[model samples]
Target: MKLSIIILAKTDTLSLFQMTLNCIDSFYESEKNIDAEIILIESNKDYEASGFKYPDVVKVIIPSEKFNFHKFLNIGIKAAKGDYIALCNNDLLFKEHWFSEILSLGEDQNDIMSFSPVGKPKINTSNSSFEIGYKVMTHIKGWCIVVKKEIFQKIGLLDETFDFYFADNDYAMTLKSKNIKHALVYRSHVVHLEKQSVDSEVKSKNIPKELLSKYKIPKYLNDNQYSWVFNNEKNLSGFLKFHNKWGSPKLLYRKNKLADILIKGKLGYFNRFFLRLKF
Candidate 1:
């Protein structure tokens, strides 16, 4: 089955586009069985105006309005004719044989909706599996994920509810609710140049207080739910706090753990404890 790669891109980051192309080129160098088709979903006219060339890219789709990541991803998925579809951000760089590794995983497990390594932990060679308990939450970094076309048909599409964050988790949760399995293929890896599309300085100053507050862990989550959200936040905050010292990662980690236990129970404690090992 051919592999169709879809990259949701904007006009500002041409370097990121080049990096993605290089990643695809490396994939082809290692594995020749796959037919790679790229769909560049662009919302800006500057990209068209720049006249950047994607020699290997099969098609490009430019939207008239501002880009809605999830919506455009759904559009690309529908346009894909391959048996397997890969959805990724324009900033990700894949390792050679990444597609081959995903194909290997899919060969034995047809139920998998998508598969990629958990990027929270440093990418390394390790083989382990444990059920996350609450519900399997897929980060969908928009960096690297491979899914069968049928799964997309079954699950409908990414919920437009989340214009940015939580859309992937929501989609994974939806698949889990229907008993579909999601796997993590550690062997296939991608380096995510996170938030490369958006200007970090602008985002830091411009994102409203309300939006920042929205990303916080809600008070209502149960032990497992709280643990999941807390871990996700901790991962993000750990990196941010590391570089900027906005707050102490240790303090935030402990505070979140205590909050989870107080709000939920022992399950939260265990989840938090388990997460700490990775840090």
Candidate 2:
């Protein structure tokens, strides 16, 4: 297939998963020329992907009862067999011709190691005019990073040592360290409902399930069905290792970034302040 998407669903409610599938089907109804396959990696057998209509979309069930972000991401990437691989979260709603934009960009710039889906920008907007290709980017939105299969061959898959946090940044730093390029795609678009896998005191304070339902953001699965709770304990421990491993300018840059978010933005949630962090 031309593009293979890897969705690591930690714990997705069946209705939410159906909504995600429906979103993809809606977008691709027009882009029929592009042969794409979605590879879903389920951390457990919470829901059956076989229930979906897209047969070409493959599903891999890894028995990670407790989700480890990097581990399942690596598992998906290793299993992917596309010219391009898109690492995704299950809570996204894609915009029109998202595939065309990314695939076309890859043709012109070959050194791109990663791309952030034209995410929930400060300005919520999307345009398909690829008039300008991309902006050189330092940070990749881990929720939606698209890279060539070969980049993995070059830089290697995620450092499992990261376990849950900063793996995307670590990979980005590795690319920067080697003088490889990455970018923010200005043209394409995908709506990342930054609700799932968050609500952690470390990253994003959990948006109440009621709030999520009110906004129609796909929600946390049933506790009896499948559920994910990010481990703050692991997140802190992982960050320290990341701080040490990619030290100096790299880690310093990350530290600065955390400082910026903690200082500049009002994420509304008080507890997850990175700048307030002692370490």
| C-alpha local distance difference test of each model | 0.59, 0.61
Query: In model 2, which regions exceed 4 Å deviation?
Result: 49-56, 63-66, 121-139, 197-231, 248-251, 254-279
Cα TM-score of candidate 2: 0.67
Task: Estimate, for each residue in 1-279, the C-alpha lDDT of model 2 and write its tens digit.
Answer: 388888876444566666567555654663677877777776646455645333455555565546777777888887777888888877777777776777878887775656666765435355643322222232466778888888877667777787666676566556644444566776677777775645345665444545434332123322333223322444435545655665443435675565445433544133234322434
Could you give candidate 1's per-residue lDDT for residues 1-279 as a string of tens digits?
A: 788888776655667567656755665675666777777676666664676656655487876756665788888988888888888777666666777777877886665657664444444444543112222334344456678888866667876554555455455445444445566665666777666675443233233345446454333433453343333443333333222321234554564455445424434324323432423
Residue 132 in candidate 2, Cα distance off native in Å: 12
Clashing pairs in 2: 199-205, 199-206
Off by over 4 Å in 1: 118-141, 199-202, 205-279
Cα displacement (angstroms), candidate 2, residue 162, comes to 1.5
Candidate 2 — what's its lDDT? 0.61
